[model samples]
Target: MSQQQCACPKCDCSVDSQAIEKNGQRYCCEACAIGHTDGSTDCGHNCQCGK
Candidate 1:
């Protein structure tokens, strides 16, 4: 089986086995999923720089 990858363009984190789906796009987490919703770079978090 092939491992799935995060659909977030600003993020390169892998989704591993389970991928968070939002509007047909896959993400690693809720932050990433929501961030990419508006096509903005803001991930609603202050962990990673410019995430």
Candidate 2:
């Protein structure tokens, strides 16, 4: 019974199996989901990406 995690490479948030799926990757939030589509890990806000 391990909890699933977001598929965003730069994200460390936990996600459910029914979380947002994009391009076969699971994202905890919309920012992570959209950011991943553009190859950006910034999450569109002040994050580790520094953008």
Candidate 3:
């Protein structure tokens, strides 16, 4: 089967993947799916998000 290109639900960006389901739901990347939840944190062990 051929690959499908779709836009991210959080951010409008093209993503190529062959595993997309028929629901049209897709995530460009794990980072994008995570979203601003991490933005509040500093990405360090001291970050509250990690807690």
Candidate 4:
């Protein structure tokens, strides 16, 4: 199956098989799923989409 992009509008990372699902949306990490509540855009990955 093809990987899906993160649900976050600013995130360009791809969601793997273990993608984090929140409210029926798939995210690359918790930060994306929570809409960067802490004002942090880092998803513990290399990409700096939220920067």
- Please give the CA lDDT of all the candidate structures: 0.63, 0.67, 0.39, 0.85
Which should have the higher TM-score, number 1 or number 3? 1
TM match of model 4 to true structure: 0.81
Please report, as a residue range, the 10-residue window in candidate 3 with the lowest summed lDDT.
42-51
Q: Which ten residues in a row have the lowest lDDT in candidate 2?
A: 42-51
- After the best TM-score superposition of candidate 1, give how far the Cα of residue 36 lies from its true spot, in angstroms: 6.7
lDDT of 3 by residue, 1-51 (tens): 444343333343444553333344654444443543555332222323212
Report how far off residue 19 is in candidate 1 (Å).
1.4
- Using lDDT, rank the candidates from best to worst: 4, 2, 1, 3
Following a full C-alpha superposition, what root-mean-square deviation does model 2 have from the true structure?
Answer: 3.9
- How far residue 41's Cα lies from its native spot in candidate 3, in Å, is 11
- Greater TM-score among 2 and 3 belongs to 2
Instruction: Provide the lowest-lDDT 10-residue window in model 1.
Output: 42-51
Q: Pick the candidate with the highest TM-score.
A: 4
Cα TM-score per model: 0.57, 0.57, 0.34, 0.81
Clashing pairs in 2: none
Q: Report the lDDT of model 4 for residue 9.
A: 88
The sequence of per-residue lDDT tens digits that candidate 1 reaches over residues 1-51 is: 466766766565666557778898777777677774555554444335133
Off by over 4 Å in 3: 1-10, 18-24, 40-51
Model 3 gets an lDDT of 0.39
- Per-residue CA lDDT of candidate 4, range 1-51, in tens? 699999988888899889999999899988888888878858888766666
Total backbone collisions for each predicted model: 0, 0, 0, 0
